[model samples]
Target: MRYHIGDLNPEELLDLYRAMLKPRMIEEKMLVLLRQGKISKWFSGIGQEAISVGVTQALREEEYILPMHRNLGVFTTRNVPLNRLFSQWQGKKSGFTQGRDRSFHFGTQEHRIVGMISHLGPQLGVADGIALADLLRRKRRVTAVFTGEGATSEGDFHEALNVASVWNLPVLFCIENNGYGLSTPTKEQYNCKDLVDRAKGYGMESRIIDGNNILEVYTKVNELCNAMRKRPRPILLEFKTFRMRGHEEASGTKYVPEKLMKKWAKKDPIANYEEFLLEKGILTEAIIDGYKNEISTEINSNLKLAFDEPAIDSNETKELNEVYQKFDYEYFEKSEDVENIRLVDAVSQGLEQSMERYNELIIMGQDIADYGGVFKITEGFTAKFGRSRVRNTPICESAIVSAAMGLSINGMKAVVEMQFADFVSSGFNPIVNYLAKVHYRWGQNADVVIRMPCGAGVGAGPFHSQTNEAWFTKTPGLKVVYPAFPDDAKGLLTTAINEPNPVLVFEHKGLYRSVYGDVPKNYYTIPFGEANLLRSGESLSIVTYGAAVHWALEILDKHPEIDADVLDLRTLQPLDVESVFRTVKKTGKLIIVQEDTLFGGIASDISAMVMENCFEFLDAPVQRVASLETPVPFAKNLEAKYLPKQRFEAALLELYAY
Candidate 1:
């Protein structure tokens, strides 16, 4: 079918024209507010509103749109109240994010619009996941995700496309190729002549459009939307346009040469489309002015209302609001008796129970389906649950994380496994920037658990043996749990799954097989911010978790005179400060041991907390023992030397002497 401006009826043509004009006027008002010092910043979509505004008009309300910072026109097209948009820019409590976020970093669950983080590339992978869910449920709805040409440089762009192609997900990867990435032009940004060429390798459909023509954009996207509903597949749509202004209002257009600016000036999307409507006799000048005046009045009234709304108080925003999902403890309680089980067995069992209890729970990882995972932790799971629930994903770690985020956002619970915790660096953007901050920024706890099999001691090299829980602990709105015993591991995993928050479960591979104890067959939870006291002693307090707890116990057994109180910190993010203070007051000396590197490790934070809280009770300075700063070595001899036994023993002796 031929797709063009002629496809639309007279009313539809006028609707498109009004849609473009609304955002154009709103941004003009925003620039005025920016200059008047009312709003902090402005990202104007001055010349590039056509694709977003037009394509949004083509989409159904049930469909999802993942928009980046530049897509103000999409909001206008979706009929997002002008007051809310202005309130967001003004950082008012009445905004979508309740003043926690600004400039495209907001989403409403009712609208089915997932906001894009500053690092916008990863949301495409999330879009792929949302599309995957729709495909699995046979929803026949397409998810359109927007990104600039610069974001295409991110790894998530490639990963999202590859997975969407392989799974035949109904996702529209909308690329606004606006000639430059910040100050650098497209020539320097990528080697490809056209960005759509990259989609050829992924075996997906591609289309290039003159973004200046609003009707052409609407017709083409509308056609693709219908096509994807029948047979799901990703389509890369490249919109060639210009930013017309600076990257942000403050950045200025000094980078663009006058000659190039003049060239793009003639092809402004709004002006060009307005002329098209005039010549076609679809809209008279009087009718157009009437629409503009009506919208302008609406905009001004909303801005006034937004200004009158009370600002959020500083005390109200001081603490994180609703970081975790509220659930009764009885919901997670199991009726079965306790049984002796290995840590690994407890993990698989807990997972099976969680899945059976909650039908929406799903597990995804590399080699998790038939292969039963790298360490056999998921053995017999695929046979019991089937491949639909126990999914085997590709090696793209970021995609897995982002995909899980999307699923969680759509009212499903997900447990994602990183084959090895050390590989999490590959997927850090979505985990840290998107998943971790979603609750704090957008008021929804992403209900997902990432099972991280971490730490050294096995023959696995540096790539597989690193303990990086400290990195995630530092991130707000993220819960980090590290369990030492089989019972704790099973209980914590069960609890983490129940909580409506993005939790990182650090399962030490060394402890998975090496440890065995009584694990409850019935579901029970060890709450966050609670510490377990394994052995009591009066002389010293030894705080540790995971694999280090066993090592600390071994050292204490070797020297009975040390008489240490061993405390296991099950959850790191919500530290058990009360227990730590009590133990510090009783023992009068603190020794923190960790398997992670010495500098900036968990021990450092605990040591500081101890000094600040119970310093007067201490008989000596707080001591911390940890692994060497160097990478974990492959050689057994070098690895043993780098490990934390000798250092811990020395610290123990010094504390004993003190």
Candidate 2:
């Protein structure tokens, strides 16, 4: 059956032709630059221009969009600066990211275009998140995410689709089915021939369109977008187009069989649409020539602008570094007179006060709303704050964390509880990729707090006994806090909630019931990077935090003659390097202690910092007392052996001999 150009006016047809010509011209010039070694790599949407331009034009200006690397057509059609696009390809300061991010990782808040992430299929979840936000805000805006058929194989794709369909979110999932995922064809990847069939399983509206026919692509997308805006729901559109160019600049048609290449070449989407426009008398040969010349001139002008741009300076790089360092040490000054309160109560009071002051603050997790969390940290919050502010989430850890990230992105202050710190692995991806990197990627902060009960003193055994703070300490763009006493817990938690980045607050299970100290009822926030000196002596310095801080204090009390200086690192990521250097410089000896295994523990980082900052002042090598490198055993005696003890008396006896 022949697909007509549709009953559109001459002006509309000319617009479609113009959209097709711009991307094609850009792709053609990019290929020349790539071949001449001017650009490192190029991934062009040569034959698939019709599909991108048609679908994007059908979207509303306020609707959200997420495009993949081969989406130059969509960006060009949306009027993104061609100069910035070329600058990004050339890795120049004039690029969209100032040469920090890869090409095609472009974004513009003004245009409602969400940034493109390098990780495939993950954007699908991001699209759903944006749609969810729009729904909550009553914005009536749809989210359109474009990806390839290969992205469907990722776990995030299924997860996002299932959630979008279940919630009836306004999202348009466009799959550019160009017959092959790199070298692997669709038949090799799955048994089903139609990608739209997969969408039906999720109870979403699904359709397949002839991508080569610009009119058909635009007509279907327009209907879908209109229906979505009225009563929003998820829909999947699979555009069956052909890839005329190779995957990237380096790839060639050597692997592609001659017969198959010729077959796909016949159905080239751009060429077909141009011929259709010419046949319909909507475009003349002179107009086409003029369009090509205009596009060529624009490309050349952008190229010259990119080359003339100034180089990045070292100060600029340093300033970029400061942007990710969100933790401010100045706000964490210690009180001369410490308060006396229980650790659990201090945590609860901090959260309660924050919620009272900040109306946007919302808390959620297992048993948090009604049960006040497993440790009673959030007890009575639901009764006081109501259900909207204090929520109880299902047992899906991934979904809970991801939803918190989404909510935070939409201007809500979200505090998520992980029943136990060990259970954080379930939501690791969202924490690392979405929550932590969102601000760095888009220059938009997501203020979210993750509270978890951690450490290994309660005999909770293997699954519940692990300390995973080190895992996040190694990651950039995250704040890790571990407070020892009640006052510090209240103060640090207040700071964590107020900070504009993702913060992980690890509350020791033992300290929740054991430790007590004075905490003020007024609004007070503790700084994250400053260390607290529990006891000030000069012979040796014992540095620790969380449950170990209590043990160190006890040891210091028992052995008065040792003259040990006890330092508690309240925040692990932005460590108190100043306090550590001062103590090491005066005492000339250091000992680091932690409950986690010695291998890749937080103590290692402390030891490295000491060596780098105060190596000359050291009288002896720094020592570490940590749990053995084995899983916590169920047997009480074995567990005792597996955990790290203060051993202050023994250390004092040895130090006296020296």
Clash totals for all candidate models: 1, 9
* TM-score for each candidate, following the candidate numbering: 0.96, 0.90
lDDT of each residue in 386-411, candidate 1, tens digit only: 88788888889998899988888777
Estimate, for each residue in 92-200, the C-alpha lDDT of model 2 and write its tens digit. 7666665666678756666767655666656676676677767766778778888898878876677778778877889899999886778787888778879889987
The weakest ten consecutive residues by lDDT in model 1 span: 322-331
Candidate 2: list runs displaced more than 4 Å.
1-8, 315-342, 359-413, 433-442, 646-657
Model 2 error, position 542 (Å)? 1.1
RMSD of 1: 2.1
Error (Å) of candidate 2 at residue 483 is 1.6
Superposed by TM-score, candidate 1 places the C-alpha of residue 494 at a distance from the truth, in angstroms, of 1.1
